[model samples]
Target: MDYSQLRFVVEIVETGSISKAASNLFISQPNLSNQIANLEKILGKNIFYRSNRGVTLTSYGVEVYSYAKALVEQYAMVEKKLMTRSNENKIKIASFGSEVINSQFFEICKRYNENNYEFNLCECGVEAAIQKVNMRDCDVALIIYSDFQQNKLGQLLTAQELELKNLFQGQLKIHVSQKYPLSKKSNITRKDLEGLFHVKKAYLFEGMFSLDYELQFLGIPENQKTILANGNKTYNDALHNLPSFAIEIDWKCNKALPSDLNRIPYENKNLPITCGLVKRKNEFLKEELSFFVEKLIDAYG
Candidate 1:
């Protein structure tokens, strides 16, 4: 089949509806349906089982879709290599944490400039970052999740056909202003900050799986005096100005922390943090992207 039809199948699987995929592909629904129907006839197998909800891939359709996706990626790579030299030097990255962006990201960008490449970094939640990579909008994604979330996150990455590489693992710690009483302790427990306000950084796409979920898994009570901050500056302000505490991984807070704030290791063996890089599965990394990935491994791994 033609590359256009292959792309149509992949898009249909991605959107899970012919109407949605047609809208995205800028084609009429009837035309798209006709194309898929012709493809199935050529293959002599029904590719999708239709229902009110949407389309579900049949068993054989799964194999066809897999090969089609790889072919599409390969074709795109060839076209990009041959025709997109001007855009080749640009790398797009999405990240979940400001700490990662401020620390490793800037350093990587500086090194990338040595090769005369340009890069863009977007700060978003894990799901949004994954979507950017899956949709080929970004070359890579950097995200941090608690060890407790490993299984769920793994399933998510698998569903999106993304590959993950571990950059760092850190123990969870509490960040509090130096003036706060809990800051005096070398280590703190859940009980120590019972009455103090907890500054929770609001995530864009955390869903039901997040730091709060991890805390609940650790048997910690939900923060009673909670304040939500939409961004890093506001989160830091809450920690500095108010008698509040925030939880973060040790390595992330090791740098870019205010002088007035201190990071105290929380005495919980159950809560660990993992930071990593993600990219499309089986996709070839361009020269600049490969170089940057190595720099990240050297710096953090």
Candidate 2:
């Protein structure tokens, strides 16, 4: 299929409706439908199951959409370069989250942007971050996994021609408001947190690990009261306003989080987290990436 046709597929999937997608793409609904029909005939596979409610991808359509979205992104990148006549450098970053995000990370972005460079930073799960690197959509990725995950995850990354550089080991800890009853404790055991409300960061749909797995890793019981918050702000709010706790790879010195929070090491069966960088194998580091690495070191220190 042509780039425009693939672009059509990506737009439709993104908007989740042909009519809205048509509006966004500046095309008529009938023309968009015809384009989809022509593409389906070419591939001999129905790309979407149309309905009154909206369109959803068929089983095979889901597979097609993934590749189509990536192809669309690359095509647009090339088109932008061709039109502008300037080969601008764009730093694409895919990250698991807060363990690696600190003040120094943004400093690098600020430095690059001052020179008119572009950036794409996605806060995603482990699988999504790895997928971005594998698909060539990202220049580098920041990730965290226990040593136990490294045996399998390492091999898989190597097979995909990716390299993982361990930056440092992060201590996983439970954070609570200073107002929390157990906040004074230096080390937290499961018993100390038992029956308390918990605010947690959870990833969904992009290869989500079950809640049992999260609880197991945090050394908490299944019966513990839990609520889900998508980012640190909400996690902090929950801890501040309620008798709750949250888990994160300890970046206790982060100024972005509230000063009144208490970060206590979670003492349980050892879960050694390795925070690191992932990049394509044998790739030469760009100046921005080098600066990013140096600043990352400073941020961690």
Which candidate number has the best lDDT?
A: 1
Model 1: weakest 10-residue lDDT segment is 249-258
What digit string (tens of lDDT, one per residue) describes model 1 on residues 105-221?
A: 677677667555677888777878888999988998888887667888899999989999987776667888887777899888878878778887677325645676666665555
Best by TM-score: 2
- Where model 1 places Cα greater than 4 Å from the true spot, the runs are 1-88, 98-101, 114-118, 252-259, 268-270
As for candidate 1, its clashing pairs are: none
- What clash count goes with each model? 0, 0
- For 174-291, candidate 2 gives per-residue lDDT tens digits of 7788886788988888787777887777752135322345447666655448778777677678889888887766642423543687778777544556768889999987898889
Model 2, residue 95: distance off in Å is 1.6
> Candidates' lDDT values, in order?
0.79, 0.77
lDDT of 2 at 291: 93
Q: What value of lDDT does candidate 1 attain over all alpha carbons?
A: 0.79
